[model samples]
Target: MTGESGTTRLPRQRDTTPTAQVRLLVAVGTDKHPFDRLVDWLAQWHAQAADPVRLTVQHGHTPAPGVPGGVPFLGHDALQQAMADADLVVCHGGPATILEARRHGHLPIVVPRDPARGEHVDDHQQLFARRLGAAGLVALCETREALHHALATGLADLSRYAVAADPHAHEARRAAVDRVGQIVEELVDRATRRPPRWRAWARPDRGAKETR
Candidate 1:
C-alpha cells in the first residue's frame, strides 16, 4: 500500500505462522529529552533473555542500547511498518504512540518518562499514562521491575498484548484521547492564570525607592 507520503508501505497483515521467535518493537518517540532509563531496562532484559526474540528499538535522543536493531529515529512509514510487523509493541508514555499502537492492533506496554529523572519537561506523560492505565488501555510500567515483568510476560504470551482493530475499539480510544486533551488544556489554562511565586516577590513595596 502507498502511504500518504507516496512511499510504499508494508502490508498490515501479520505473520500467523507458528514460530518460536517473538517480534518486539520499541519506540521512545521523537522527544528531545533522553529516556535512558527505558533503554537501560530494555538492554538488561535483552541481555539475559532465554527465549528466541527479535527486538527493534527506535531509540530517538537516548543513547543506543547496543542492541542489533537500534535506530536513532524512524520515519512515519517506517514506524507504521514496524508496528504492523511487530507481535508486541513497547513504547513511552506519549499518547500519540499509544494510539498508533492500538490502531495497529497492539495493546502497547507503556513506560512513562520521569521528569525528576530528566526524561521530560513536566509530569504530563505520567498523568496521561496513569489515566489510560486506570481505564485498562495501555499496560503502564513505572519501574524497572515492572517493565522487566511486562517484557517477560509479553514474550511468553504475545496474544495478551494484542488488541482488536475494530471500529468500537477505535472509538473508545478516540474518546480517551479527547479526554486527555481536555485535561492538558485545563492544566495549561490554570498555570497561565496563576502568578508565579517569583513574580509575587518582585512586586514593588509602597515605600520602596523609585527608579530614576
Candidate 2:
C-alpha cells in the first residue's frame, strides 16, 4: 500500500520464512503533533548508510520522506511485536515508550522532543531522556552528528546499553509514584471545597445591585 507521501509499504513474508537481517523499528509515538525532524533524519540516515539496514517506521502525524518499505502507523499489538523482533529500536524520548522498548529487552536510542521547536507540549521528554541517559539506561542524542555516532558505535552492541537492575531504578520509580499520589490527593482536596455562590455579590458597591 502507498503512504500519504507516496511511499510504498513493504509486504511481509509468510510466517514460516526465516529472517536474516538486523531489523530496526523507529517509533515516533502516537502524539497528535508532528515530529518531522526525526522523520527526516531517518530518511537521510537510510539514504546515506554504508551498509544495507532493514528499516521500518511508525510515522505518526509527521511527514516522513518516502522509504522503500515504510508504514505510517502500526497498532499497539503490531508495534509491540515489531519491537520484540527488532535488533535495535529508535524512538522519541517518551518515558512510556522507553520503558516499553526496555520491556522487549532492547535499550532504545532516544531523540528527545523540544517544546521550543514545537515537538511536544513541554520539555519533559528532554528532562527524562537526560536522566535515563545519565543512568546508562538509554542512548540519548540531540543532534544528527550524535545520532550518527550512536548508530555506528552503539547499534553493533545493544547489549551494552541494556538497563541493568539496580537500587537507583527502583528508588526512582517508587519516589515518582509516591510524589504523584501526594499531588493528586492535594488537587482532589482543593477541588472538593465548596465556595459561597453569592460571595461576589456580597459587596454592595463592588458588582452589587444599586438601590432603585
Candidate with the greatest TM-score versus the true structure: 1
Candidate 1, pairs of clashing residues:
none
- Encode model 2's per-residue lDDT on 1-212: one tens digit a residue: 45333444343221222444557788989888788888888778778776666788888888765776467788888987887677778899876678767756667899988888899876667766877789888889899887777776644555554443221244555565566456445544564567655543576665655332
Candidate 1 vs. truth: CA RMSD?
A: 6.7
- Worst 10-residue lDDT window for candidate 1 reads 3-12
Give the alpha carbon lDDT tens digit for every residue of 1-212 in model 1.
Answer: 44333444332345666664688999999999999999999999899988878888999999989778999999999998898889889999887898889878788999998888999887778877887889999999998899889989987777778776532344556776797678766654654475544433355553444333
What's the lDDT for residue 1 in model 2?
A: 48
Q: What TM-score, computed on C-alpha atoms, does each candidate reach?
A: 0.78, 0.67
Candidates in order: C-alpha RMSD to true structure: 6.7, 12.4
Candidate 2: worst-modelled 10 consecutive residues by lDDT: 9-18
